[model samples]
Target: MDGLLLRTNYSDITEFILVGFSRRPHVQAAFFSGLLCLYLVTFLGNSLIVIVIQRDPQLHTPMYFFLSNLSFLDICYSTSWEPYVLTQCFKNFPTISYTRCYALMTTSLFLGMTECLLLAVMAYDRFVAISNPLRYTVIMNNQVCLQMAVGTWVSAFFISIVPIVAIPANFCGHNIINHFTCEIQAMLKLVCSDTSMSLILGLVISTFTLPLPFTFILISYIRIVAAVLRIRSTEARLKAFSTCGSHLTVVTIFYGTAIYMYVKPQSKESQDQDKVISIFYGAVTPMLNPLIYTLRNKDVKGALRKLIGGKEKS
Candidate 1:
């Protein structure tokens, strides 16, 4: 049995090649082009958010602070995925070593988890604004917002370390990850050893990382909705709901895709399907965020008008 097991091992299997859909040269070329464009747009959109938020002191509220961080994270998130795939177009086989794999996985997990925390924080900001407009500034002051932001990154930092320490113990088999990036699910599937520990770690982290944050967001919005309903003024309630409505929509898409990817067991039928969902959370979500936020936001539009009007006046 030992000899049989050894027989299956090939010297060339040291690197796990990505079987990214469609080996056809045309399909691959199209994929590379498309991903490159998305990558560029992702950076530009997020960078503009950061720049505009920082430059426009009037927009220096908790909302824009969170938006700037979100944009920065989106930029980093895309970097964690796109650079590897795009490099493949130029190189014969864009290979990542074990050390690189571990690093990439850690970065992706860190940013992904951090975004989970940040989104929850943003939801709370919206919740506070709609529910208690009288005390918005005092409630979401610079010091308070700073703590929230710092706490988010720190939580993700320490939380990510747990997985990094855990993953190295598993005996890597075939060392190939199927997706564009070194995702946790992709890494776990290739391990030769028992996955019980990885699963347990995933469960533990996911509790802090997902459901609780989701629960908080849910509770906040539930209260928010209730408060909005009580307001006899139709115009005020409608205006409040409009802002919260956009946030709710964006949250549902972001969390819905994320929950689909990570919450369920990836059965054989769902594995390829999961890949598409991963693209939704990992790629599509970032691109959509700035568009959704800026276009939907009345303040941002007003600011843009002021910016353009000032330019025209000059």
Candidate 2:
């Protein structure tokens, strides 16, 4: 495929130029300020979560274990493009170097994959807790939790390397990415080589990564609902259901927008629509996750309490 599509020399494609959002002054400025604040919150929120989880031994459970990993992945996932996007607010045409593009690809791929896996693991944890409440403690032991977290990271890293190999070698003579980040789809579009494999590979990866996790999440919730209904205690059932509400909402938003953006082919109208969704997933989702999922969590609240007390005492 590489040899066949070599229209011109290969060495000319040295950088990937990103044509960011338009030159509208008010829009640019507004976006700049808004994204800057979000990025700051993302860094601070995730950092705080990790610190609290570490310092507060009470949070060393399976749920918080995955949640902390999720937060870390969200930070990496957002930073893969958010800072670059913020920086591009004033530039007439902000260009990301080829190496930077590759770096973004690698980081985004790994982080995105990690987030997906984390969601899956979280689903399993929910399933175990809800479906087998009596044995949840035994099932979600420290060793098992560590294995799940480590396994998720390793799987994501392994799968992400394929694109790094393919993209750099086949990007023959053009390197213009339309979005702020080095997107997998946008980068694939720039490649001069046969994209059949890339497209297929993308479809395959997206299928394996998203649908199964979502299915497990759906199953976990369905079982949770059944368990809740069987409960004679109304208040207990409602309280039990509340535990999954935030996570389910997050899963819906993340997977729904992601599928709409990439799984289905985009018309020109849809492409314009997709840019907004992409921004949501890449930037907005990370910002929302901490606020919605962790901040609202009672255990996290307790950890924060402990942290504040420790600081005041010292």
Candidate 3:
């Protein structure tokens, strides 16, 4: 059959050409500079949060524990691709080895999925804290928090790998990827075989990763808001809102862009749009997370100040 012949003759793609931003020198230069700066900020900000939380005994609570994990995830997530993307800016035709491409894709997917579940867990933490202040410690004990964290990472890995495993090795023969990184949807566009199964599998996995966790977050917030409203004191209500506002902002920025990117139909016309949106959740949100939490949180800020004072006194 002709199909058999086509399959037999298929070229084993050794590498993939990443067609990143505009080929213009000016555009590449600007984007490289902007992305480099963003990466640095993201690294430093998240790193600082982790270090501060680890050193501060006051911050050993369930909330900061989750935040530290989030920071670590952001560091790993961005590092998986940003350096490659930066180097590609200098090349006329940027290429990634086939094995490395898949590795990066799998890593990013696992981390992204972990973050989604982690965020939902964090929302649940907030709900427990605000709704049952007295029982919060008992409910979210060290063992429970550790189990949740472990479960999030483990579940995300399984979820991330399933769709990847489903994709036939020879599904894509094309060597050119039109996006910056080895994003699944972008790679899907290059498939030489029928993509219906791949797309369906991706949709099912994405539902569990994105929408399901997102819905849990929304429900958790609804309950949190209801609990806060029942508080009689204006000061208590303001305090509750203040504690949650940063997490809510982060969830919105991350999940909003993510939902848009993954949940929507991927089209040829939307590749550029996809890149732009990816930059938000991928780079911008990570950089902003530390700033948002620190600026809004008195406890984190106080701990930061105390750390600085201790260093200065030494």
| Winning candidate number (lDDT) | 3
- Residue range 86-144, candidate 3, lDDT tens digits: 98887876888877887887787788888888999999999999999999999999999
The CA-based lDDT of model 2 is what? 0.72
TM-score of each: 0.87, 0.89, 0.93
After TM-score superposition, the amount by which residue 175's alpha carbon in candidate 3 deviates from its true location, in angstroms, is 1.3
Predicted candidate 1 versus true structure: per-residue lDDT over 3-88, tens digit per residue: 00111233334445555553345567776787788888888887877777877778899888888888898999988867787887
- Provide the lDDT at 209 for model 2: 75
Which lDDT tens digits does candidate 2 get at residues 252-271?
88878776666776332213
Every candidate's lDDT = 0.72, 0.72, 0.82
Candidate 1 overall lDDT versus native: 0.72
Model 3 C-alpha RMSD to native: 4.5
Candidate 3 Cα errors over 4 Å, as ranges:
1-11, 169-172, 268-270, 310-314
Worst window of 10 by summed lDDT in candidate 2: 1-10
- TM-score quality measure for candidate 2: 0.89
